[model samples]
Every structure is written in structure tokens, then in C-alpha cells.
Target chain A: MLLKAEKITKQFLRESRNTNQFCAVQETDFTLEAGSFAILTGRSGSGKSTFLHMLSGLMTPTSGRVLIQEKEIYSLSDKDLSAFRNQHIGVIPQGQSALYSLNVLENICLPYTLYHKNAHQEEALALMEQLEIAHLQAAYPSELSGGELRRMAIARAFLRKPELILADEPTSDLDDENTKIVFAFLQKAAREGAAVLAVTHETDVSQFADKVFCMKAGVLTEQNSL
Target chain B: MKLANSLPVRNLKGKPVRTAVLLLLTTLLTLTVFGGTLMIISLKTGLHSLESRLGADIMVVPYEATTKSNLETIVLQGATGYFYMDNEKYQKIASCEGIGQISAQFFLASASSGCCSLSVQIIGFDPDTDFTITPWIKKSYAQNLQKFDIVVGNDLNAFVGDTLTFYGVDCHVAAKLDKTGTSFDTAVFTNSETIKALIQSSVDKNMNEFKNINPDAVVSCVLINVAEGYTVEEVLNDINIHVKKVKAIQTKDMISGVSDSLSGIADIISLLIAVVWIAGIIILLLAFTMSVNERKKEFAVLRMLGASQRKLAAMVMQEALLVCLLGSLLGIGLGLLILLPFNQLIEELLNLPFLLPSAGQMLTDTIAAVLVSVLSGGIAVSASAFRISRMDTALILRGEN
Candidate 1:
């Protein structure tokens, strides 16, 4: 397995609420195998994004362990964990993830720059071409449309060619044609032996996944094989 | 990546207005610090120079000269004036008890000199028995001063080999003395013979204010050092009581007024520096905090993209470091441009002595000011950098903050 979660849970304190405690994600056991595409579907406030953040090593679980490549990721120091994430995992965050100061090309090459390595410009350009954003490489995020920005974030996520891809609402602002382009690219990456997990409410996303799951009221359940 | 293409540099370059504002704030901070420090140092230096150049414990002047405050005005305020007493009075002061060393001096004033349009004070000393002006003048001109050869003060507009005409007598400039940062820098120094000739020439041209006085039989004032076994008060009392027409004054009493004024000005400059420093740091703190708070999502995105917390903090500090380093250099440059060139004007305005420190001292001060400015900038941004580094990345990305 490329990724696994065992009895992961998240709780937040609510000072104004009577209970004074809120569980955003209940106990959950999950695993993602290599070379497979998975889809997580849920309503608003269903804790889908929270779960993805935990898997991406961004949010710590209140209880339980997250294992990537059979090693507990949260047990590592912050420096080692960040380095591991940079080398093995790529995340497509929701809602305008571009750095704003950087143009589209530099944003796509940021993962390499962070580690002081030479950016793979050829790979970035190819990904941009595949997403139909090649012509906008020199444009800043503010100058791009919503659909273009979403496409740019997709291109950046795939720049490192990591083992696992976690995308949160990656296609929320995309049009029908651009959404088709993004799904096709993720499906292609999965075919090439990268485990891809994307959270989305789009009904058409199910067709591109090998397995589908649904979340409700902080509870997650496996639905069916696509 | 090269530093020019680094994320922090790119961020600052992307927002020109914000970068400019931060740069301007640091510039103001450094300007006040460097400029105020240099001014205080110069004032202190000038005061010390004045004290050393006075070089006498007791000065006996004609009583009428004290009544008119002519001696004080000429020595402390750089005003040009002359007073004379009979040679008999000088002999009486020399014969007084508790006197260790004594020298007689003659004074003359020129309405307009050869080198400039300003009136100049001409002081003549007896080289054979003098203990004050000769030792100081020898630092610049070691050769024995001839009858008409004069040594000009540093502030004079005359140079060595230049001839200055005063009261229809031509005097050759032998050398120019170093700056004393006192009224002495504006005077002309020559031997008693040359000054006597100038005095006689003034009387011949009807320029002498005191008519029917013989130039050869009169002296301007007597400078005295107290004998080692006696106090200055004893010598001053002996001279004042024994002399018929002269008043004895202590040099320290004359300089006390100047010292008090210098102390007051130093305190004010120090207070101004403290206020500007405190206000600058506070304003910088607020600026950094607000800027970090406004960019929560951007930093959150970097965190999600695998930037370590340390990296985030370092980037913020790097921006501040760049601004402070550049701003401090600019401020020091501005300080030198304004302070050094207009130092004379500043001295005149404050009516105090002003001298710049040596080149090495100035260099050390420059380095210290830059380090202080940059360190203060670091301190100002440290809190904001820490807060941003430990922020909740998930919530920030979710737009909850």
C-alpha cells in the first residue's frame, strides 16, 4: 500500500457550544493501493477535506496513526516529514492555490525550488501543454481565470510525479471541458502507477475511479467498485 | 535558486508599494540614529577642544574690559575686540605672589583682512616667555616665527605663503594651525613686534579707538598658571588685590557657561534619539504583524506545498534583513552628506564648538549604526515570523481565518 490510515480521528473545541467539543472526523481506517484511482464523495461539512489534510501530513490526527510506505508519517520530525512529503506526495489544495507572487511556470516548479534542486522545466512544460495552460505559463495568478487557475494547480501537483496525489476539490471551478481534461490526466497518472485520491462532488468523477467512497456526518463508508 | 530569484525577493518585488513603505520606515530609523549620534559626538569633541585650548588657570584683564565683557565676547563667542592696559599693570601682575607662569599678550582687530571680508582678531604673544600659544602653534609650524611672519588659525581663509594686510601693515602667513573648534580658530597669531607695529599703524591711520595711548607701553591681557603649591583661588586673589587697574578671572568659571549649554544640548539629542528609536520599532512591529496576518492563505499554501516551518520563518526574516541592510546604508550616506558639509553652519547656529571625530572613529560608528538598524529590524519582525510559522495551515487554507 502506498498510504494507510488506522483509526484516525479529529476533534475541535467549541467554546460557545453546550458540548464544548466537536468531532470533525470520527474513527476511520483507510488504505490506498498503488496504481489505483480512488474517489471520495461527500456533502459540504462532511469532513472530507479534513481527512485529506490528515493524509497529506498537513493536519495531525487527534488519535491514530498515518502510515505512508508502511512508516508512521506523523512520528517523523517536522523537517523529515516535510522532505518526505515533498519527494513522495503531491497535494492539490482547494480554491486558488497559486502563490500569487510567482507566475504559472514558477509556481509549477516550486517543489523543486524549495529543495534547491534544478526544476524540471521540460516536465513542467509538458504538463502545462497537457492541461492546455501552456500559453499562460508567464501569466500571474491574478491575471488568469478561475478555470485556468484550477488547471494550473493541477499541473503543479503532477510536476514532481510522486507516488500519491491528494486533490481537494481540484475541479470545483473548472468547466465541463476542463473538468474532463483534469480527470483524464489523473486517470492517466494512476495508469502509470501513481495512487490518486481526489475529493469532489461532481457526479461524473465516479466514472474515472477504480473505487468510490462516500462520507456523511463525519462517518466514512466504502460504497462500491466502479 | 539564486538569491535574486528567491521566493522572498520575488514576493517583495511583486508588491512595490509595500516594499517601498518598509524601506522608507527603516531609512527613517537609521537616519535619526546615525545623525543624532554624530551630532552629539561632535559637540562633545568641540567642548573638550575648547577646554584644552584655553590652557590657563587665571587670566588678568583690564577692569574696564571685564565691565564691557569684551574679553568674554572675544574668547567665547568669536567676536573680534581689543583692550589694552599699561605695561606697568602687566609688571604688577608678574610680580604678584602664587604665580607660577605668566605671559603678556597684545590684541588688535582688523575691519577687513586680506583673505576675507570678516573682521579678524590678531593675537600677539611673547615667544620667549609664552607657555600657551607657542606650544600649540609649534605643532603646525616648528620654525621660530620672524617679526612679520604670522600663523593663521584653521578657520581663517588664508594659507601659508599668503600675505595678510592689517591696519596698513603687511604680515606673511607662515603656517595654519589645526582646528581647535574654539574661537581661537578664527584668530591670527604673531609675535609681539609685528602686533606692536600693527597697533602703531592703526594709531597713525586714526583707526585706534583708545587715543593718546602708547602701543609699545601697553599690553592686552596677562595669562597666568598658578604655582603648584597654591590654589588657583589664591593666585587670582593675589593678582586682583595687588593689581590696581586689572581684574583676575578663573578660566574654569569662564568655561562653565559653555559646559552647561553643551550638557543641555547633549541631553536633548539623546532624548530625541530615544523617542525616534522607540516609535520606529513600534511602528515596524505593527507593520510586520498586519502584513503577516493579511497573507495567511499564501503562507498556508506554502505549508501545504511542503515548506517546513523553519523555512517559512527564515523567508520572512530574509525580507526584513534585505530592507534593513539597504536602508541603513542609504541612511548613513545621507547622514554624511548632510552633517559633514554643513558642520560649520551647525556650529554657528548652536553657538557652540563642533569638531568631527577622526576617520577611523567615523568608520566604526558607521558600522555600529548599520548593525543596530539591521538588528532592530530583526527584532521587530521576530514575533510575526514566529506566529506565521506556527499557524494552522488547514484552517487558513479553508478560509476560516
Candidate 2:
């Protein structure tokens, strides 16, 4: 197993006294194997993205532990956890995630440079070329279209070639053709032996996913395995 | 090429207007700090130079001359006019009970002689009885003044070995005095013999007032140093009572008016600097806050890409430092351009003695100003850097609270 979530749960305090607690993600035991493409489908506010955030080490669970390659991620210090995430996990966030000051190519290369590591330019360019954003290499994010920006975000996640890829609504604003390209790229990442976990509302994502899960009202359940 | 270049530099380049405004504020802060501080220092230095140049407790002048001329113009402003008391008056003042050192000085104006472009005051000191100008002139020239040998002041156009004509007589310039930012800087110094010759030549030329003067038997003014335990007022009163037709003036009384005006100007400059500093820091705080706040999402994105909170804060600080460094250097440059070239004009406008610190002191001051300006930027934006760095990445990424 590349990732194992053993009885993980997240709770938020209710601002109003009418409610005792708000559960963003309920108790859920989930495991993802190496070389597997998984999709968790849910509508907005369904907590699928919240679950993915926990798996990516972006949030701490109220209880329970998350282990990647048998190493508990949350057990590390904040600095260590951030460094581990940088070297091991790649996340494609929803909405406008690009750094406005940087161009498309610089944005894609940020994951490596953020750690003060050498960014491999030939690999980044190859990825941009594959995503069809090669011509927009020097274009700032503001100049990019919704679909083009989505592809650029996807390209940035793949720049490091991490062992775990977590993408949230990566295809939300992408059109059908661009959506196919992004999913194909995710499937290719999985085929090359990386565990890929993506959250989306598109049911068609199941066609490219090896394992499909559904989250409704903070409750996660495995639907089936491809 | 690695596409990840310095992000802060690019950020500043991206937002030109915000950067320019911040730059301008930092520039103004540094300008006021450096220029105002320098001006205050120069004024104080000039005052000290004036006091040293005066180097006397009381001056005895003819009462008729005192009626026509203010003590400040004759002593501080280097105004030239000849007024004489007999050698008998000098002898009486020298024998006063509290007198420590006494010197008799002669004054002759070269303005009417038409040997120089501007009105130059010619001061003739009795080398034997003089303790005032001779000791200062010794710093430049070791040899005593021969017949017409002269030591010019720092501002004079003549150099050592140059011929300076006084009353159509060629006076040899033996040496030059260092700049003191006093009237001495514009005056020429020589022995009594040279000036007596010049005075006689003026009378021979049939000059209006010079024709009536007797340079041999008269002394222009008697400069007196009071004893250590005695007061200038005591000695001045003694001279006034004993000497007939002579008024005694204290050097301190001559410069008190200038001191009061200098204190007022110094206070105003200090207040201006305080206001500018407060305003500069506030402006910088606002600029950084807005710039950082607007990029919350962007910073969140960087965090998600595994940028540590420290790295995020460093980026913001780097941008601030760059702006501050550039702004301060430009401000210092602009200040030098204004203060250095127009120093004389500034002195004239303020009507105060003005002397700049040495080049080495100025260089140190410039470095200190730049460091302070840049450090201020860091201090002002520190809170913002901390706020953004410690922001909840998940909440920001989700675009929610």
C-alpha cells in the first residue's frame, strides 16, 4: 500500500450553540495501493476535497493516523512534514492556484525551487509541451484561459514526478477535450507506478480510475474497483 | 534555464505603481533623515568654528566706530572698516588686572584699492604681541611673515607663492589656512608692516577716508583674553571705564543672536524628521500589508507546493529590502547633489555658519542612513510577513475562513 488511512476523522467546532460539533470528514478507513489511479467523487461541500487534503498532509485529522509507504506523515514535525510533502506528494489545488508574479514555466518549476532544489528545465518543458502549453511558457497566469490554466496546474504537479499525486477538482473548469487530456495524464502517472488520488464531481472520471470512491455528507464509501 | 528565478524581484517588476510609491516614500524618509541630520551637524560645527576663530574675550574699539558698525558685522561677518584708538589706549587695556593675553590688530579694506574682484578684508596682526591669529597661521606656515609675505584664507583664489596685489603692492602668499567656514575664510592675514605699507599707499592714492588716517600711531582694535577666574563682563567694564572714547564688546555677546536662531532651526528639523519617519513607516506598513494580503491565495498555493512558512516570509522581506536599498541610495545621491553643490547658497540662505563634516564622516553617515532605511522596512513589514507566513494554507486554498 502506498497510502493507508486508519480510522481518520476531522471535526470542526460549531460557531453557533445550536450545534455541538461539525464533522467535515467522518471516521473513514481508506487505503490506496501503489500504481493505482483512484477518484473520490462528490458535489461541492461533500468533504471529498477535505479527505484529499488530509491524505496530502495539508490538514491534520482530529484523530487517527495517515501513513504513506508505512511512514506516518502527521508524525513528523511541521517543517519535516512540509519537506516530505514537497519531495513525495504533488497536489493540484482547485480554483486559481497559480502564483501571479511567475510565468507559466516558472510556476510549473516552483515545486522543485521551493525546496531550493535544481528545477529540471528539459523535463518541465517536455511536460508543458505534452500539455500543449509549451507556446504559453512565458505567459503569466492572468493571461491564460481557464482550460489552459488547468493544464498548467496539472503540469506543475507532475514536474516533480512525486510518488503520490493528490489533485482536487483538477478538471472542474476544463472542457471535455482538455478534461480527457488531464485524466489521460493522471492515468499515465499511475501506470508509471505513482499512487494518484483525485477528487472530482465528474462521473466520467470513473473510466480512467482504477478504484472509485464516493463521499456524501462527510461519509466516504468505496463504490468499486475497476 | 531554471525557470524559477527570484520571485520578489519579479513581483516588484510586476506591480510598478505600488513599488514606485513605496520607493518614493522610502526615498523621502531617507532624504529628510540624512539631509536634516547633516544640516544640524553642519550648523553646530560652523558655530564651534566661529567661536574658535573669535578666540578672544573682549574687543576694544573706538566709540565712534562702534556707533557706525555692529559688533557682529565686524567680528563674525568680516565687514571691513578701519577704526583706531591711540597706542596709549592699548597700553591701558593690556595692564588691566584680569587681562591674560592681549593683542592689537589693524584693519585695512582692499575694496577701494580695486586689486581683487570682491571686497577682501585685510587683517594686520602685530606678530610679537598677537596671540590670536599667529598661532592659527602657524598651523600652515612655520616661517614668520617677512615684509609683504601673506597667508591667505581657505576661500581665497590665490595659492602659496602666488602674488596677491594689495593697494598695488605685490604681496607674496606664503601659505593658506584650512577652511573654518568663518569670515576668516574670506580674509587675508599679514604682519603689521605689510598692512601699514598698504594703508600708506591708500593715503598716497588719495582714497577718501584713508587720507585722514595715521597708520603709524594708531591700533584698529585691542583683542583681550580675560584671566581664567575673571569674567569678560568685568574686563569689558574695566576697559570702558579706564579708556576714553572706547567701547568694549564680548565675543559671546556677538554670537548669541546666531545661537538662538540656530536652536530654533534645529528644533524644526528634528520635528520634521520625526514626522517623516512616522509617515514613512506607516506608508511602508500599508504597502506591504496590501501587497501581501492581496496575494493570500498565491502564498497558499506556494505553501501547497511545499514552500515552508519561512520561505514565504523571506520572499516578502526580500522584496521590501530591495525597494528600501534602492530608494535610500537614490535619496542619498539626491541629497548630495543638493547639499554639496549648493552648500554656499544654503549657508547664505540660512545666514548661519555652515560647515560639512569630512568626507569619511559623510560616507559613514550615508551607509548608516541606507542601513536604517532598509532596516525600517524590515521592521514595518515584519508583522505582515508573520501573518501571511502563518496563515492557514488549507483555509486560504479553499478560499474560505
Top lDDT model? 1
TM-score of each: 0.96, 0.93
Tens digit of per-residue lDDT, candidate 2, span B85-149: 78888888888779999999988778543335687888999999888898899899988999999
Interface RMSD in angstroms for candidate 2: 1.9
Q: Which predicted model would earn the best TM-score? A: 1
Q: Model 1's lDDT to the true fold?
A: 0.89
TM-score of 2: 0.93
The iRMS of the candidates, in order, is 0.9, 1.9
